[model samples]
Target: MISSTTMGLLVLLALSIPVGIVLFLLGFGIDAFFSPFPLIRGLGNLVWSTSNNATLIAIPFFVLLGEVLVRSGVAARTYAALDRWVSWLPGGLVHANVATATMFSATSGSSVATAATVATVAMPQAERLGYDPKLFSGAIAAGGTLGIMIPPSINLIVYGFLTQSSIPKLFLAGLLPGLGLALGFMVIVAIICLLRPDLGGERRMFPFVQMMRALLALVPIILLFTVIIGSIYKGWATPTEAASVGVFGALLIGAVFGTMNLSVLHESLLGTIKITSMIMLVVIGASFLNFTLASANLGGALEGLLDSMNLTPFGLILVVVGIYIVLGFFIETLSLMVVTIPIIVPLVVAQGYDPIWFGILMIVLIEMALITPPVGLNLYVVQGARKTGRMGDVMLGVIPFVLVMLGMVALLIAFPQIALYLPETID
Candidate 1:
């Protein structure tokens, strides 16, 4: 049954069917052929219960927060400001791309939004400055993935919801590793540019006073991140409520920056609706599929199969990581998470791994998925923002950063405390 299900998923996806539809079809197939009891009768209730969560409200709110920053031109200013601060590095403005994405990721929960926001603002600079499109665009694509691993992350929220884990703890768990990954990206860029000076564009250092002044442009985003994350950590608000606060803060900041108007708000709303609808559809479909899979006892079969392997707990985790890497190349990040969380999380937990730590580790892998080939959403997003460039450039550019991500995965496995320290310290 597992082998057949895997084959069906690949076949449907290869046929170019939408991921949401594929999940629904898989659920119906399992109900008809695999389950002893009827699963179709409960579909409506399952979807309602899945979508009715208040925590999920954070999705649209965070999307709007990113949209507001992008439409109001604040994102551009922030990118330029970071350019003043980090362009002196070996990779020049590419460092700014990664820095801007890291800053934006603190507030923007969606990796796609983070990537789009950075690409929209930074692509023009790359063309004008004569930077290699491959490395510059690759930095944006790879850096934007920090969105999921950073706090106020939509992916972490979804993982928490599906696993019944504490969302705030998950957020805390992701913080250290996320920031570490961003720093790792910057270091890799520096090393590469140092080795091949031509790949890096001109390195320009702003005056010290000017660099200090550029810090002002970053204030709004930092404050917004602090408010959203602080509220949750301080026990003053839930994640959903904090997301509402983030939207209001973003709007107020937009107004203070003299960029807020009805047009911006209107566009932000439309973007939010489009993104939120897409996410909810995938979530709803996955919920039904998970219900059907559980009814079919797919979890039992998977667990029994693993138990028969007689592997160490660490070996089991390595296998899980391998599964995600392989599945990630074909599946969209959200679809991948929603589909596998039910089956995989329980098995890992049974081996005595912490879910919060595992959640952070999963996100690191998902970050790689965002930049990987064919199905990597971030790669396409960065490529689309380019006025002239082959998609292959973006693909080739991400190779080094993907290796950085793999090292991050190994670090997380070898030293679980990287993800756990913040949460444990706070508790």
Candidate 2:
């Protein structure tokens, strides 16, 4: 059955079908070929349950927040500000890409939105400056993955909602690791540029007064992050409610910045609808497929496989990590999490591993998945932003970051506290 599903996915995806459609086709195949039950009957229920979710409502809200920021000129200002601060680094504006993405990650919940925001504002600069498209675009795609790792992340909220973990704790657990990955990305860029000077743009230093002025440009994003995350930790609102707070905060900031107008708002709303609808289609399809897969004894097969291994706790973790990396290559990040977490998380917890730690671990793997080939959403996003470059450049650019992610995985394995320390101390 597993073999059959794998072949089906390959054949359908090779035909260049849309990922959401491919998932539906695979679900139907699973129901008809592998399962004994009439799993297709559950499709309507799964679609309704997935879309009607209050928690999932955060998806649209976060995407809208990013849209407002980008359409309002805030994202461009923030990118320019970061460029002033980090352009002196060895990698020049590429460092700014990582920095801006990190900042936006604090405010926005969606990685695609973060990538789109950064790419929209930064891509023009890459062309103007004669920077390598691979690293420039790769930085945006890889850095945008921070959206899921930072506090107030929609992906973490979704993981919590699905796994029955505390959202606040998940948020806390992500803080340190998120920052660490940003730093790691910078370090890798520096090393790469240091080895081959031609890969990066010339490092430029800004005056002290100009740098201070740039600092002021960050105020709007800082305030928005505080409002959204503070509301959650202060018990003033649930994660969903905080998303509403974020939307209002974005609008107010845009208006105050004098970038808000009827046309801007309309475009923002339309962009939000298009992205939200795209994501929801995949999400809804994934949920229905999950229902059918679960009913078809896929979970039982996974359990039997794990049980047969009879490995130690650490060994079991490595297996899980391996599983996510392999699956990550083929599945969308959210769908990958939805389809596997039900079967995998329970097994990891049974091995005496911390759920929060595992969640962060899974996120790092998922972040890698975002950049990996064949089905990586980030790859497609970065490619879409480019007018002429081949997709392979973006894929090649992410290779170093993928290595960084591997090291991060090993670090988390060596010291579980990397993920658990902040959450444990906070509450």
Top-scoring candidate (TM-score): 1
Clashes (backbone N, CA, C under 3 Å), per candidate, total: 0, 0
Off by over 4 Å in 1: none
Evaluate model 2: give its TM-score.
Answer: 0.93
Task: For candidate 1, report its TM-score.
Answer: 0.99
Give the per-residue lDDT of model 1 (tens digit) for 1-427. Answer: 8998888988999999988899999999999999999889998888888889988998899889889988998889999899999899999999999999999999989899999999999998888999998999999999999999998899999999999999999999998898998999999999999999899999997899998998999998888998999999999999999999999999999999899999999999999999999999999999998999999999999999999999899999999999999999998999999999999999999889999999999999999999998799999999889968699999999999999999999999999999999898668
lDDT of 2 by residue, 137-241 (tens): 889999999999998787797788778898888988888899999999999999999998778888889999999999999988998888887887787888778
Clash list (residue pairs), candidate 1: none
Error of 1 at 348 (Å): 0.4
- Residue 89's lDDT within candidate 1 is 92
lDDT of each: 0.92, 0.86
Q: Which stretches of candidate 2 lie over 4 Å from their true place?
A: 33-37
Candidate 2 residue-pair clash tally: 0
